[model samples]
Target: MRGVPGRLRPRSLRTRLVLIATVLATAAVLVCQATGLTLMRSWLIGQVDDRLTDFRPPSPVFRDIADGTAPVRRPPPHEALPSDFRVYFYDAEGRLLPDSLGSGRSEPRLARTIGDGLPEDGRPATVPAEDGDGDWRVVADPGPDGMRAVVALPLDSVRDATSRLLWFSLAVGAVTAAGVVLLGGAAVSLGLRPLTRVEHTARSITSGELEQNVADTSPDTEVGRLGLAFNTMLDQLRAALHRKDRTERGLRRFMADAGHELRTPLTSLQGFAELLLHDPHMSRSRRREAHELIAQNADRMSRLVDSLFLLAKLGDAPTTEHGPVDLLSLAADGIAASAVRHPARRVTLAPLTAGGVGDSGELDVVEGRGDPHQLAQVLSNLLDNACTHTPPGARLQVRVGSLRAGPRTGGTERPGRTGANPPLPSGTPVHVVEVADDGPGLSPQDAQQVFDRFYRAPPAAGVSGDSGSGLGLAIASTIAEAHGGRLELDTGPGEGCTFRLLLPAGRP
Candidate 1:
């Protein structure tokens, strides 16, 4: 690799495939030609033997030769001893006697080939002619009057025909080889077109254009399936990389926001600590004020860290322990705490009114399956979000109940209902809770990203640090979703804001 150039290296798959196909095709053609030649030669030799087997010597000549009279000499070309066949005779004593078709010029070799009499098995045998002119297919058999007859046919015509055929076959094979080279190359290229596109797109990816994708092909073909699968993998890889990029960007932003939030409290603590340290004679009241400020900022920092950690855990850890929890009791506890914490705040608990609604007089109970503590945390965060944003005189309502989305009046009965107990229609179940406040609500833009981490609502004049952290709604939303529920905000400018939370019910 170091000494050789890249182009000279045999790295192309298509070239290898085409080369293999051409070689195999050429070999196949050669085998066919060889088989055809062999079969043709056998067929020609069989025809010669068949003619010799059926041949009969002239009756007068056969009798004369058998009785010791002189045999006839070679005839004229038109009547020349069956064209090229040389007929011979032999006495029962194994003496060679010539008849039609004189072969004095090549008699000895022919005699040696024919022998003194007819062969016992009587099959034709091919042997070289005298003077080594060409091949001959000779047969010997018993003729009339105890005389043995031998016939020899020169193979010159068959050799010539075969030679010509061989030449023609060679020419055809050469042409076929050339055709294979040409057509095989073209076919291989066409078959691998999708792979070529994949290679091009892969090269582009190497050059940092990861957005480029190979074109998809049909799934029925091998190369097409390969291309489609590769493109799918590329799509998935691209999506994963994009998600990683967004995550990195979000992480950077989160760190920046965390640093900015932490800096305020840290700076405050440092200033207060320095004041206490540097001024030993400072006034007691001033010293107490610094202490309280320091404590408050310390608590804020701790809470921010805890919120960030909780969000991180939501993704990394498995879900919390879950079971049936009474939703009504959780809501009441959270709402009561919020009202007590803000003594002047008007927090009201309202009965949820809907078909198949909970009965307040009968101590309506709605049970949701989840980790009780986490669910309580979700309720508390929602209350805090509402309390901090709502004005002091604003009315806040905690609404809870169940609702059926479709066919509310069906004949089906609710869970735990028996014929003796009550006939509540069996229906699909859904749990709903709403935290509503009659106060200045968020604008559309703010409401859109209200659950986004680090999102801060538009500031009001008298807002406290309770709304400063900006992670309560985001955490609460994540917690709700983690419990197979979702928190959605329905608010507009000047309209009272309501945070609607929906949870999965017994029915899908």
Candidate 2:
């Protein structure tokens, strides 16, 4: 008994729904059956009472009595009564008349208990049978001379009819309840098919099938909406996992590249130091050359370490300071520096015209918000990469301007310069600085990974200069992203390269 509640408790949604539906249906059936039985019994008893009250004698004696004529002093002849019925007579003193009783059948003898306190009024009532067989419907009819006649109808037929009906209703109710359980279970299971699919998809994902997705993602019903939401969540999770994997791969590659870059300079420095320490008697000029080589390697190592540290800092906190900066001025400065560093290269700076083309227009201060120092580094890196990688006498031009950057649509021209696609509402004003060079550009493979740390394009023929650390373009790109901007490249083999720096345009 202690475990009965636990056993009856519905553990699943399907069970609970079917159980509740079946119970309600059963209750409804019981209530209807009970009401029907009560009404049927009342109607049947009413029918019995009517028959008893409507009874009449066939020998003219009852008609005479009903007409207020006194009954003969002697008892009337015993006439046969109707089916399942009996009749009796009483005197003015309430005494049973001799030989007055008659019945349609035998075995169910009328009890004396019924005649002892008979009703004087003309109404119907119930009385018991002598053999304890059943109850009877009794009615008393008054006559002249303080006399009355009594009639009784046995209730066996009414009981039998009601009993049979009760059994039939019980059988039907039981069948209906069973049908409710079976059909209700089937309907509930059908409704939960989407949930079942979701469960299967979840299990598949848990078992390392990352691409598994629910198939019933319609947006109409509640279950459909649930499936749609689950599918959406799964897609997002899959994308997040992919991004995580990519990030981890990039980190590992960065570390390996950093170690390799540092190892080269460290090896050179160690060799030079060992030579200087072990060969103390070497010529003074050779010793001085060794010292210079050591200094050069040390400086290279220092630059590599500084670039790695800067990249790390950017990763942690991309931008530490912000201020208004003029891209036009920054470009001019970078061109001047590039001209000084690579005297043979033709470097120039110009402003872009309002028509989305570069020209000899008067320089306009294309301003943006960022750390001036970092922005300067980005411009310097672009100029250096252009001048150092391109052939000697390559024309390197820097163009700076402000324009509304629109959504990317796979166009060759820069944003706001394309006529094929319209701009989106998210278009914003940005200062674009283009460092373009007419030199043998990189191949498609090299151009794709130009912004990756330690990635370098093969130098053009007759192009000889300090390649410096490969972190220049990578650092520039990082700084641009940190400032809520981006650095893009357009190039192909022999088409020349254009490194475009786009930054948000603002003064505050």
Candidate 3:
């Protein structure tokens, strides 16, 4: 047999509301019914007690016969006792007296024993008995001549009344519960109407309607508070959308300017190439000049295109990778390469002693599962940036070390000391790399925007213009994020800037 498909079944709000209301109403009705039944039972018992008190024998002759002072004989006519009741007389010898009116069945032995013990003051005593049909209550009182008078009342009438009352009350409670459920469902739906409106409004906003706001004019209630919160969220969303739009427009304009820059170089290269091709008979010095012009412009255009491609790739690269990387080695290689590329700049490395999770002298070598190439690119970008912005012969310091941080600590130990205690163990490691320059640093405002793409600081006084593609720091930041690390800059006007890269140094 095929199995049934598993799917979520949504419950109707109306039905749920109705069911809840019905449960509450049923509980209340049951409480009321129980109380009513208790009082009704008490009232019925009192009525039965009063009837027993007021019972009397039929006549003087019948009373005499019941007392056993007269012989068995026919008695005078007498009115009947109440419905469900019967009268019987028995003598002191336990024989049926002549005035008895019920069927000829013998009196119960318990009823006779009760009659015999009746007080002379005529106080009635009640005893249980059964008529030919069902159970009855028998009350016995002594007469003046040693005879006893007994009256019996059937219980069927009271039982029938109680049963009818119970059924009727149940019917009424069920009807009331149904009414409450219906009305309660409608009320709940009306109460939730504002939430429905808010949901629709949010959907509309998500479908490109940025100016929409939730309705906030309702009375002060939970729905009103919800509406107010929704309106505030829309306001924040609007501001975010505006910022995103501005960024997109700025990016378009930047691309246009870059395109113009590339086009100018290409146009110059093409014009010079055509001139050299058509003027093969020209002088050697003129030909050499034309070729140099073409080559220089072509080289410049290639560099610009390469920078643009690098920035685009950085922006679009995936942020997750799965492979172990040696961060320490990567940083060392990047610093050495950048120093070689910028021969005039001075680059220095400070060795870090690892002392935590592992005992290795280096902090677990800052091993992590990531893309090494991307990490190297990030380091290269930071280094290139430091070289380009700082003055010639400026000292660039790169330091790597481990520190104690985070919630847990573990690892091996490495033997070393800066001053007093040996270096920390390996497992308890937090890797950090700081790249500082002793050149003119950025102002506070410039430092804040330095990591933003296409942002460059104002020209420094008494120095040649900066040579940069303006995306180096931004690309570095993107790479840091991919490795679950952060790139932070510390700088102020006239105080050199230090760029720090902090990452966890352990197995991920």
The candidate maximizing lDDT is 2
Listed in order, each prediction's TM-score against the native is 0.81, 0.74, 0.50
Against the true structure, candidate 2 has what lDDT?
Answer: 0.76
Best by TM-score: 1
Q: Model 1: what TM-score?
A: 0.81
Q: What lDDT score goes with residue 15 in model 3? A: 66
- Candidate 1 Cα outliers beyond 4 Å, as residue runs: 1-11, 24-28, 58-82, 94-101, 104-118, 130-133, 144-147, 183-195, 213-231, 355-363, 405-428
Query: Model 3, range 1-508, lDDT digits (tens) per residue?
Result: 2333323332776566778778888878878887887788667755765686588765675655644586444233354333444667766565554455544333432433434453234443444444444345556676555666767655556667777888978997889888887788788888778878888998998898879888754557887888888888888888898999998997897787687777878899889888888888989999999889888888877877786776677568745465877767887899889868987777877655433221234333656556788777778887888777877766787766666532222121212101011223343445666677877888766776787766777665544644565667777777766565556776677778777665555537
Give lDDT tens digits, candidate 1, residues 322-407: 78888889888987888787777777776675643332534368887877787787788888888888777677888787775322
Model 2 TM-score on a 0 to 1 scale: 0.74
Candidate 2 residue pairs in clash (backbone atoms < 3 Å): none
Ranking by TM-score: 1, 2, 3
Comparing candidate 1 with candidate 2, which one achieves the higher lDDT? Answer: 2
Candidate 2, which segments miss by more than 4 Å at Cα? 1-25, 52-80, 83-154, 177-227, 269-295, 320-323, 333-346, 354-359, 404-429, 504-508
Count clashing residue pairs per candidate. Answer: 2, 0, 31
Candidate 2 lDDT by residue in tens digits, 204-291: 9999998887888788888788878888898999899999999999889988998899999899999999999999999999999999
